[model samples]
Target: CELSSNASVSPGNFILHPSCDYDGLIPSVVFFLSFLLGVPGNIAVIIFRPNFQHLSSVSQKLMLNLVVSDLLCLLTLPLWIYAFLYMWTFGLVACKLLTFFVYCSTYGSGLTVTVLSVQRYLLVVHQKNWTHQMGVRLLLVLLWLFSIILSIPQLVFRQVTTLQNKTLCQSQYSSQAQRITVLLVEGLVGFTIFFLVVFSYTRLQKKVKQAAFFNNPQTTRLVTCIITSVFIFWVPYHFFDVLSAAAIFLNNEDLLQFCLTALYTVKALHAVNSCLNPLLYAFTSHNLCCKKSLSPKI
Candidate 1:
């Protein structure tokens, strides 16, 4: 896919490439904001309070994992911003490794959220804990394993490709079928996580309103924001993937073009998602994450 810009390219004029203006500027700014806000917030969550790593509560542990994942996603923003304004000067290995980190962080975030929701459902509605810390620890370990395995394709396929005389970091699949398969898999997995979260939250709604821990208005608001933010920020990013896969499958060039042009914008929205978690889970969840009476224990 080619980067679209406002400046018209005359015939055989490959030097006039896309700049930081037009399509590039928006995502770069979004990435910058996400980094500026997300890094400090996540760091505060980890170190602001005492014994952060020694958290025993299942929710707290999962929330920490989520914070770490967002930080992983946020840390890559400087490299991305530079790539957007100039080029990917970090070479082939950096492209693969950096992109791999992004994939792992994203999958880890979604999976952590899924498991956290399930843990809450059991506690609030079923009156059951995870039984032992070992179980939760093992479960988190498995999630990371799965995330890395799923991200292998990125490590294998992403490269620094010179497009329109600009060195850009992008994925290059062997065929349309390969590209479609990867896109479909990522979209399906994301939706499955989304569906599970929705299901758990739906089950918790009535119970939570009556439950002691969820009685705190701040707790209730935090839960609602957590659920709503996932949909608002991530749905479109995945939606574009599904549509892009369909466009390639149908050989619809126009639809593929539209998807390509708009996909970066959706990715910026996804970045915005990572930045807001600090506010939702850390700053605003003083009642839920910090309070002994409100935060349910394992």
Candidate 2:
């Protein structure tokens, strides 16, 4: 979804009306703060890479990619804030380019989490093997390639249009069918991958509890927090997107407006995940290191 310009009085059929005229101001301020927090947090993760080297190769790589993806998404927020504050004065090409990057990064981060969950599942359920490491490397490459391919549609559909004497950047679908198709694709891909991640983690948790072997409370708690954080941060965004798309498909203006308003609020909440992730990492590292030091060598 794209950010709408504040100057546009009418919310349009696809857009939702905010409860107040200055609703955009709240989100803009939130986005600006998120950028300030997320950039530094993610950069710190990159700079402190050696501290995380104790994590498995796959886990380390996935965490790094996740940070990079979040950073890419966060980098586009300043542009979005500008659009929300004034208008999309960056012209057509910049609009498409920035939108493309945002979608790419969003998808990339989601897929990375899915892969990370699977890696953790494998580590707990199966014996370590060289082949698993090789497979993970290959999967990482495929995940990024798929994310880029999925994001190409955004570049094709997004346009900068003049509305109420203000230029706005948004997805300009030619038909409702086109919009539905895009929304369904995005929702399905994100939900499907996240579902699999949750399933894998659930099963892993069950197996770990059943065996009662190598069951570190700190590790278990950290994993639970990570999974919970992912769900809390992303589920609402996807749920609201699906609801908004359904409203559009049914031509329910009232429902569409409500969903859009809710979406506008949830979108900032979704972006907060990037800022929260670094803190999660810090907790995970500290807990795991302490666990390692205390555990008996078998």
Candidate 3:
């Protein structure tokens, strides 16, 4: 609760320094909105099975996996939103578990998107069907396994401590090196996925441009919009994360403060991105939209 000039933040210690005030009015609202839209949107896709016809069955399965991960992020929003607006009344165990699941789910979603894009590219451009029915399951297993591995740091470091009589849930770093190391690891993994998605789509676009018989159902607009939202919404989250690492490495308190503050905006953007795809797919799918056109008056 109290900030001291020389605080020891070692494990089992309770005096961890708080990051800047990330929980503000605007970010809290954004978290609430993301929860409102994302929960229903993802659930709709699951119940209705909105299909993107251009994607192969393999890609569709990957998408289903993605929806689960998105739901994980959305489901945790209420806890985070409440903590922002009020306080993290949940105990340290809850804080650790919640943050761990969040890190896992966010990483899982990013990896899923990257894999989906790459699978699409390979199917479209190179005609490479590397994974069939059985392989996909194994891929999913490995994906989550990696996600859990990466999320362990969050579980280990995330703690619940009070600030000004209001409980806060945040990661605690014992040393400057520890903070930088964690952020760098997270940033590298995230941006690596981002670059993979970009590369996959870039190749897809190039190959499509050169193909003479590229006249399919034209899912280009739909797919492009999804990828665009990923970059538009998720890229800043990772960018600022990396910048925060840099700021810490350089010991620039002002820069570190600025990057941490900017995270509030990018977090909102990322939450919106989580829900955007469902609206895109649920509304855009021709088969799904036209299915009920012939219904008699109920």
**TM per candidate:** 0.86, 0.84, 0.84
Q: Candidate 1, residues 91-194: lDDT per residue as tens digits?
A: 99987888788888888888888887787677666767676778878988999999999888877767677766777667777777888888788878878888
Task: Report how far off residue 51 is in candidate 2 (Å).
Answer: 4.4
Q: Quote the RMSD, in angstroms, for model 1.
A: 5.6
Please write out the lDDT profile of model 2 over residues 100-152, one tens digit for every residue. 77777888888887876776566555533234667867888898899989888
Overall local distance difference test of candidate 2: 0.67
**lDDT ranking, high to low:** 1, 2, 3
Q: What number of backbone clashes does candidate 3 have, counting pairs of residues 3 or more apart or in separate chains? A: 0
**Which candidate would rank higher by TM-score, 2 or 3?**
2
Clashing pairs in model 2, backbone N/Cα/C closer than 3 A: none
User: Which of the predicted structures, 1 or 3, would earn the higher lDDT when compared with the native?
Assistant: 1
Among these predicted structures, which one has the highest TM-score? 1
Candidate 2 segments whose C-alpha is farther than 4 A from its true place:
1-21, 128-135, 210-215, 282-298
Q: Which stretches of candidate 1 lie over 4 Å from their true place?
A: 1-21, 50-56, 211-220, 284-298
Per-model RMSD to reference: 5.6, 4.8, 6.8
